[model samples]
Target: MSTETKEKYEKYYVPEQSPWPIVGAIGLFLLAFGGGNFIQQTTGKYGNEGSWGWLIFLVGLSIILYMMWSWWRDTVRESMGGLYSSQMDRSFRQGMLWFITSEVMFFAAFFGGLFYARTMVMPWLGGEGNNAMTHALLWPEFIPSWPMVETPAGDTTTAMGAFGLPAINTAILLTSSWTLTIAHHALIKGNRNTLINYTVITALLGVIFLCLQAYEYYEAYHHMGLTLGSGIYGSTFFMLTGFHGLHVTIGTIFLIVLSIRCASGHFKPENHFAFEAGAWYWHFVDVVWLFLFIFVYIL
Candidate 1:
């Protein structure tokens, strides 16, 4: 009986070893180092052109994008060939869950730094704690306040208004999330036309959000004097929202690919783990943007 069950049910399918993980690590290292230097140069801190930094960063990004496309294409082929069993699906779901959990922790660290800077660090530097000597010795005239536009070095820049472009971007992301939800339902109901249309609309919304963000950045740098060197406020503002924008870009690409797959009849009504995973990621991106809008923008 056991032999018969084993033969009928088929054994688990393990994937072959791949070199993408190491390649991806190398890409990330280059991206981090190059991107940091690129920022410094572009913000006038280094007074250099940042040509090499930009080149290395672009190369790293291209490699990462290529690896992702190739890896996902192979996975899609294997999935379409019916190589994945129920157990494999469960494993994929668990993997996605853990990945999202790690992403949450990643953002938590940034948020923690922001909170520490605002509540504890600034106050201590302003003579609020027992270290009056420290405050007087460093910046005796410093008065810690929200929307800190003045740095301790006497440098000043403008703080962006929360209700202008940021509010509009928030609305755009929220609508994209709704459109994606509709696309998910259409996929589940086997409405291919609606699925493709809604997914495309969602991707378009993501693009529009990015464009507005770009324009906002231009306004910050060109007119408002806000930049990477505009002190902690500008740094945190860009870091939080910049990473969110990158995630939105990735999500937009994911939706575009999923739309193409939908047109090619890749997902079925009941067995669409890939579609589910993309939807999960899109929704996560939406939620993160909401938090960013509230904490980084409105607050």
Candidate 2:
């Protein structure tokens, strides 16, 4: 082998096979099955004892959490011990980028659903195109409007106007993205303390955004009388916004992990796939929330 090839292969350190992935898969399976059962029970399609399903789902979630911590802990140990090579770093970067792209597609599906409901389905139902008689028979009072101020079933919710909390959250998320970027810069410059400080600030902003979102949901559901079961309008509203909230939750966890890694001196100025991966995921999340704010809340 050439000297370069020999060095590359020699430098790379692949760990032995581990059992965490399989355990994580089982945890996910349990969560999925239990969640399905719980939802069915909530909608009265299943027996009243669906609390068992929820209990099982929580157990699965706990298991998954434990698995993630253990698996990542092992990975971090290997990384800090200087086991990864340039090729390994490239692989990690590519994988994280692809994962973020998949998340983009996931959010895109929800956005597409919102657009179709507003522009096509509701309009067709209001006699805008070929279904006049059907429209008259179904919902004579149905009006097609963007932001969906009213539903055919008479459940009305004031659109979450974009002025107060939503706008504040937008600013918060945008600032968090900037803070994370600063942290990344600090990491690259080997400013460990500065990097840690910026990362913690970014994570705190994420927590603040989540808190605001919780209050927003409460205001929508309780005061505005808008709920998941309200109608198609409410269903689409909750589904799109709710899933985005879940993504935010995951991104927060990602940042928290990054902060811990940074504090532990796990990353260096030259090589830090773990830090980059967390930053990529966080930026992806920030972009998705921007779209949600504009399309779901503002527009």
User: Which candidate gets the maximum TM-score versus the true structure?
Assistant: 1
**lDDT tens per residue, model 2, 157-272:** 76677888999999999999999999999999999989999999999999999999899989987888766656666767778777787778878888999998889887888788
State the C-alpha lDDT per candidate. Answer: 0.88, 0.83
* CA RMSD of all predictions: 1.6, 2.5
Sequence-dependent TM-score of model 1: 0.95
Per-candidate TM-scores read 0.95, 0.90
Number of colliding residue pairs in each model: 0, 0
